[model samples]
Target: MVSAGLYWLLSLAFLWGGFVQMGYPGMAGEVCIAFVICLFLLRFILVKRFVAASVFNVAATVVFFIFIAILQAKGMTGVA
Candidate 1:
């Protein structure tokens, strides 16, 4: 499904950006926001299941945000 593909793409982009942001904190917030927003939009517009999609989206957002936040706050400058 398109929604599934978009979810995967958005998630991968978020993680990759977070990884890149290890050395560039300047882009971390933007990357996190973009990923989160796009992920939600994809779900809201394309997904039909209420509870299942909601849970999946929420989990992904929280995990991605935490991942980016930790990497940025720790001042990591390279992939770990």
Candidate 2:
């Protein structure tokens, strides 16, 4: 369970950093790598049947990223 938690925490952190720093393509790549790591690590730690966990993690990360992007766009427009 500890490994699973670590996987999730790291994945979320990467996503948060990626969304906040979208101007950095390198960080985006790192976030993708982190997502893949979470998928494999969670599978190994939570048992093979826990595919839902990985799927949920990916879905949540993507959703958050989209939300951040929309907010950033609005902020930029207002600033301009």
Please report the candidate that would top lDDT against the real structure: 1
Error of 2 at 27 (Å): 5.7
lDDT of each: 0.61, 0.54
What digit string (tens of lDDT, one per residue) describes model 2 on residues 3-43? 44555676666555545655553345454445556655655
- Compose the digit string of candidate 1's lDDT tens values, residues 1-80: 44545556767776566666656536554556566667667667655655577556556666655765786687642433
The regions of model 2 sitting more than 4 angstroms off are 24-80
Residue 65 in candidate 2, Cα distance off native in Å: 22
Q: lDDT (0-100) at residue 59 of candidate 1?
A: 61
Model 2 weakest lDDT span, ten residues long? 71-80
